[model samples]
Target: MLGIKNWINLNSSSVFFKGTRIATDAYGKDLLVSLYRKYINGYPKFFKMDPLSRLGFVACELLFNSEKVETLQTDNLNEDSCLILFNKSASLANDKIYNETIDNENYFPSPSVFVYTLPNIVTGEIAIKNKIYGETSFYVIDELDATTIFNVVSSSMSDTNNNRCICGWLECSNEDNFNAILLMIDKTSDTLFNIENLRNILNYK
Candidate 1:
């Protein structure tokens, strides 16, 4: 996904685990729980939903703060903006559950489990909420390569008219290990950059 510009990592274990040591270190646990509770509190079984739902909630919360976005507009999906999501773990939790259903012992399919089997769904959810409809896609790479990431983003932004993209890399190996980076870029500017310069800039992080 070559259209994001920020990183918001969350701890699923902290929210999922009830009263455990791992939950204690969640950097933004209370905030997450509070938001979720506020949005879907009345839905008795809302907490039973997937992690993507919670992530969507957080994304919406961040988007609500116009100060954080590069460009803010109304609820129009066909706008000149687009949202793309990239991740290594393509819904491993759903996959694991789906595999259990299809195993020789069970051998049954559950659409609920299959719905989140794609990593792109996370981006889709965000786009749906934000109404970004320029272009969207999901990529599964073995590792995060800055060059590759830059190339993909550069290619997508080649068309100046539709250069605004929200690119994101969200990796969630499990409930405890997850990372998300989002970047928003405008490709109309005639800016110049070199690999060495980028390397030097990124090395500081």
Candidate 2:
């Protein structure tokens, strides 16, 4: 059975790992950027990514940078792992920004803004950062459903090529209203992957 070995959750005001709060924001600063600066010092391109991409990037970084994830790496190769992400907004926040660029004559459409109009870009950003040349997919659901998520991940893992997966939900509605819950799943743990577990993890704090 697939099991979650590690997980990270980032919301508008806090960051949590394994059900423990790691950081909280009281002044309402951009928590993503703040976490980037405090925990991650490198990756200059981080500043250029949209809110969704930044959220996913930071969560992935936090998950994979740990010693537990390091031990799972095989010579810097992560091709056996797949990324499955779902969201309700599906880049709508960035779409609004991109719309404004072309909707008015004063400002031309920005290529940088246009590039992140797709929800899958966040998955791409994670893939690029980790050098993971594996299957990646993003789904836009009407709401958060654990059964749907489990089914999708299960279907993807049916292929023998996919040994592990990074799966979760990421949503960025506005600059300050965002949340990401990324989980590293494989068949090496005692905790089984099920709808109940997924719900419990996602709802934890």
Candidate 3:
């Protein structure tokens, strides 16, 4: 059975971990950057990432760094420990900005903006930061589908060689609304991996 070893939920106004609110922003203004400075200390690269990447990066950092779970020895992670992420908007939030640069003669198309036009880039950012040389997949669904996510994680965990799985919903609308709930699952726990359980945990906030 796979169980949630650590989890983080970050929306516009607040950040939660393991059902506990760690920080709250009343105005939701610059909350991500505030959280990053307060908790992450420093990572200059974070400033250059698109909104989606910044959201995923901060959430993953908090989860893996949580004292509740055993510290992840990222260097020794198994190659099969995978990342499965789903989003409703894909990369439309950044795509729009990149698209604007295409036709404006004064502003040449930016390679930096072009690189984040794909949602999978967020997964790649996490993988590279953690040294996770494992399988990574990103899916865009019409809505938050817990059953599909459960099936994917179940299938990945079934592999004898695969041990850890990071699966969740990460969405950044064109309006800049951000919502992310990332969970780290592993076979070492007795908690059952099911749709209802996942929904309960994710909706806990």
Candidate 4:
């Protein structure tokens, strides 16, 4: 049975649910594509996603589908919630790729590549897939600050309209270096989704 953990981490080619290493591949790209095909098939648009979006998408899949017992979610339930994501690298990795295409000699600007230049694209993708209709926000900071994350979560929860959230960090500086940590937190939640609590529960090494 799949274990339940507070956090999901995708580093390189390995995937951990609540720190338990359950899946691995030869490379990070292989891992993302494999997971997508396995659980999120028929979504051909997935191929157009940048590294960061792919990283977040896969991590959300693991966290949302990991445990048998239900927690926070959407779709058939049609819950209204916000998806707040934080990252330092933003879309620099994909931006670099898009830059190459716009070079003087290359000059091959692809709409698919251009669309992913926005850092918030990952949030949009997840919101669409998960049926999140509330505010979807993405912040770029110098680093991941648990205090800041908590503050944002608290602020979001303070709104009666937004009673729940899927918040965390998704960073991908390159195709090989990527990480995603997502939490499904509700205003009246039992388990606190703080970074420390999640870190303690995470079994990924």
- Per-candidate count of clashing residue pairs (backbone under 3 Å): 13, 0, 0, 2
lDDT of 2 by residue, 61-89 (tens): 88887535764465545888889999999
Model 1 poorest ten-residue lDDT run:
14-23
- What does candidate 1's lDDT look like per residue over 49-69, in tens digits? 355544644544443442355
Stretches of model 3 off by over 4 angstroms after superposition: 26-29, 68-71, 104-107
Cα lDDT, all candidates = 0.53, 0.84, 0.81, 0.74
Candidate 2: residue 186 lDDT (0-100)? 88
- What is candidate 4's lDDT per residue for 1-205, written digit by digit as tens? 1111356777776777655687555577787888887766877777878899888888777777775325345354435567788889999999999999999988999998999999999989988877777889999889877777767766766776766666777889998787777776664546665546644433236
Candidate 3 vs candidate 4, TM-score winner:
3
Q: Every model's Cα RMSD, please?
A: 6.6, 1.7, 2.0, 3.9
On lDDT, the leading prediction is 2
Clash pairs of candidate 2? none
Please give each candidate's TM-score: 0.67, 0.94, 0.91, 0.85
Score candidate 4 by TM-score against the native: 0.85
Expressed as tens digits, the lDDT of each residue in 1-205 for candidate 3 is 7877777888888888878887555424388788788778667988889999988888888887785434355456548677889989999999998988887575789899999999999999988877787778899989887887788778877878778888899899853488999988887766666788898876776
Poorly placed runs, candidate 4 (over 4 Å): 1-5, 68-79, 194-205
Error (Å) of candidate 2 at residue 98 is 0.6
Off by over 4 Å in 2: 26-29, 71-73
RMSD of 4: 3.9
Superposed Cα deviation of residue 64, candidate 1 (Å): 5.2
Q: Rank the candidates by TM-score, best first.
A: 2, 3, 4, 1
